[model samples]
Target: MGKILITPRGYAKYGDEAGKRLEELGYELNVNRSGLPLSREQFVESAKEATGIIVGVDECDEALLKQCKDLKAIVKFGVGVDNIDLDAAKALDISVGRCVGTNSNAVAEYTIGLMFAASRHIVAAGCDVRSGGWKKPTGVELYGKTVGIIGFGNIGKHVARIANGIGMKVLVYDVFDIKQEDLDTYNAKSTNVEDIIVNSDFITLHVPLNDETKNMISTKEFRQMKKSACVINAARGGVVDEKALYEALKNGDIFASASDVFTSEPPERTDWVNELIAMDNFILTPHIGSRSEESEINTVNKATDIMIELLENHD
Candidate 1:
């Protein structure tokens, strides 16, 4: 029975059912109790002897993976693996897996919430009321507005369903071809990125972070967007350049924007994130896209099952 490193703080916070199950199956649990992502040194030291790892947002770069001599597998608690070095994992003969679709609905629902919060200035209005001021903010209606979706995956499809229910006109784009049936199902139109960028009333991103998608929306895309448009990034952070986003919001290139993900987690006080946090037109959440009770149970259980299978049933 080898050790399994559980590095997500959320896992520990969600109670110890997964850990208890692992223990009953005779696998040693090395759980992170720090209530936050482990520092790099702490992560490497703990994972060096682990047979498998259940990770969240913690980075598992090539250099870090090479030091884990006893590591056999890395199973992501969520779908994204941008923090993990897949090439290095392959070279090291390590198996990698993810809890796919476990958080799709949760994240999709969150994206919609962010859209309403940004479009209507809900958060800002609440803050003003808390501070003993009464100010009504003018907002746009979502009904009958064109919403551009940048990716057409599970989460993207879920978003489209919700948007359609709200009477929104949906325009979708993806690197791969979107089936005509899916377009018909959602009453969406298949379009290119430029059409979405320039013409959409609301633009939402749902792509992963990779070489091809990094900074996919930057200064030029921001400049091309309608002055009344609102941008939403419930997906990855690197897909939109932070510096350019800061400038866009400051100059009112877009009416408002919101994001649940950032280039850095727990962004430093000295970072541009702090500036964005101060703006009434910019809404930032602490990466809580998939934090619903249902999603947490599904993702943690799936991740634990994968770890057990990899460690106990591997040939």
Candidate 2:
């Protein structure tokens, strides 16, 4: 009944429409003064007075939740809730929400686009044309290539379908097996992670960020990949060790990489990471996996609409 706290810099993009509706419910909005992710103490102090919060990648651990006594709900800006401590929120009687399957297709499309962009060095070609150079960049072909899709959920499955349509053979590596129906429909093959990594011409990740996955693709895994294989990560950061990835790229162990997320949200241009960028082998995007205008509006609408339903109908 008091107010809602919005964190980081993207409220208007994701929540402004829903905010208009919430205004009719008499909610004031407070934004984090910090321009980036909030530390636990900082998040708690700023959000303690609010009944609800719209968050983006800020730390919402048990300590922060404990301080926010009046908190009623949390609306994560995107699909991944790795930043929020759900157990504590539940114990504290706060309802937690996220936009699931909202941007799967958009992200899947971006993944394939990145693969093409990397194999063809599209970014470098644009720069070459801009610089008045006529040198045609040699780019690899995706057709007939074996694409290893790690974590075949909605996004990964969609990626496989598109890749198959483009004449690429899809090999999926999921903890769970790919269903026979799905494998047949998309003409994808299910295999173990080791085989997929060793065999894939291009590898893209689609999974959550958590214990079993943090630094999941590191030095050992890099060693398993073909020297000519490339990597794509539009999923959460830290899945591939950026440092190791840089080393691999620098040493020509892997052919190229395209990453949409980073270990750091506003990921800095570290010297090693920049080295990869300087070479044509690496492509970096600022976590805009779900930034489609339609996706943004739908994410906000879905989150706020659910809260509105819960708030107005206690019966």
Candidate 3:
């Protein structure tokens, strides 16, 4: 029987049906029972004996890939493969794939929810109610507001559609070409990042983490935004500089911000992160952007299919 190492607790929580399919294929699964990502030592040790790995946001670097002698595939449980070293895997002859479009709607919807949460102070107000306070915080409506979307991929497109549905004007930016017809369909205009940062009442990010996008939103970008602008990031954490974000919130450069992704998962509780957490204008979620019940199961099934295909076709 072949061995497959599975990380990502969310998958394990919702993967019983998918799991049975893998078992039927004669693959013995070694899933991470710990709710946390596997530590480097644990990953290398366990992955060394496995023919394939189903991974989440955990780092899969060249060094780890070199040590996993039996590995033939690294199938991403989600769309972005930023956490995995694609070039290293290719050079090492390990097939790598992602469950594309599996979680786009879930994440896009979460992005819209974050925008609402920030614009309406929904989370902070809820906290106050639970803490025995009844102060009604005045919040802004999303209608008739201008929303700027960075990275016009699947998630971004979904966000644009939702924003349009709510009577918001959409401005989009992408490094690649965005067809003008598609923009017209969403009632969105193709624009530059600077225009988005300066003019948008709400700015949302849905880009991959790469050389061009790392720290894409920083001190300068925050300064360029309207003082009442709310920023949302449901994309990779590194795309927005946390330090700059803290400063922006502290100095009132921006009215409010929310993130579902952080540079560090479950953030390390650094002084900046702690301060951001304490501020009423900031919101943080534990990376549940693509974690709706429906999406998780969909991701697991697609990831399973990829793993099966790779293992069966491997020479």
Candidate 4:
């Protein structure tokens, strides 16, 4: 029987049935007990004897992959695999799988929520009411606004759908070309990133974190946006430079901004992050883009299936 290590904090709770299935298939399940993402040392220690792993955000670099000689398969519970070292995994002959599209709807909905929260000052307004203040801040409407969607992948497509339903014009910027029929379906137009950055009323990022995409939106991009525009990043962190974002927000280069992911998880209370958090127009969420109950179940099942197949079929 092969041993499978599961390192995602939510897997044990949301993946109990999947765990049972793996056990029934004769695999020993070693789940992470930390209730948080495993550090590099913890991950290496936990994964040493396992033939497979269901990972989340934990760094699986070349050094760690080489150390875990028994590790044959890695199943990513979420879409982004930036934390996993793919080149190293391939070199080490370990199979890597990701549960793509499993959390699309969940993340897409959250992106819309962030947009509304920023545009309407929803968080600030709620705080005011709770604090015995009665200030009704003027806010912008989504209807008829131009929404720029960066990277029209699974999550981006769903975001476009919701934006269209809200009567917003959607401009899509992606590296790959989207079909005209598909664009027409959502009443969207294929445009360059520059156009989206300059012309959008609300800009939402959905790109992955990679060398090309890292710091994709910095001071220059922020400068291009209209002063009334609001930016939403429910995608990966590091895509937008936090320091540049701080400067932009502080100077009112853009009206407001919201981010669900950051360059670092449980971001340190650095001066830049603290300053950004202190701004009323800046909204931050602790990377809950795929935290919905439904999304969790779907991702867990998908990840489990992939792990089982890879391990069972390994020669």
Q: Residue by residue across 1-315, what tens digits does model 3's lDDT show?
A: 679899988777988788888899898999998887788788888888988999987789998899888899999999889889999999999999899888999999999999999999999999999999987999999999999999898889999999999999999999999998898888999999999999999999988999999999999999999999999999989999999999999999999999998988879998878989988889999889999988888899999999989888888
**Candidate 3 segments whose C-alpha is farther than 4 A from its true place:** 34-36
TM-score for predicted model 2 compared with the true structure: 0.89
Error of 2 at 108 (Å): 0.8
**Residue 148 in candidate 1, Cα distance off native in Å:** 0.5
Can you give the TM-score per candidate against the true fold? 0.95, 0.89, 0.95, 0.97
- Per residue, candidate 1 scores C-alpha lDDT tens digits across 223-301 of 9999999999999878889789999999989899999988877666775768888999999898999999999988888
lDDT of 1 at 71: 90
Overall lDDT per candidate, in order of appearance:
0.91, 0.84, 0.91, 0.91
Winner on TM-score (2 vs 4)? 4
Error of 4 at 34 (Å): 4.7
Better of 2 and 3 by lDDT: 3
Please tell me which model should have the higher TM-score, number 1 or number 3. 3
Pairs of residues at least 3 apart in sequence or in different chains that clash in candidate 2: none
Q: Give the range of the ten consecutive residues with the poorest summed lDDT in model 3.
A: 33-42
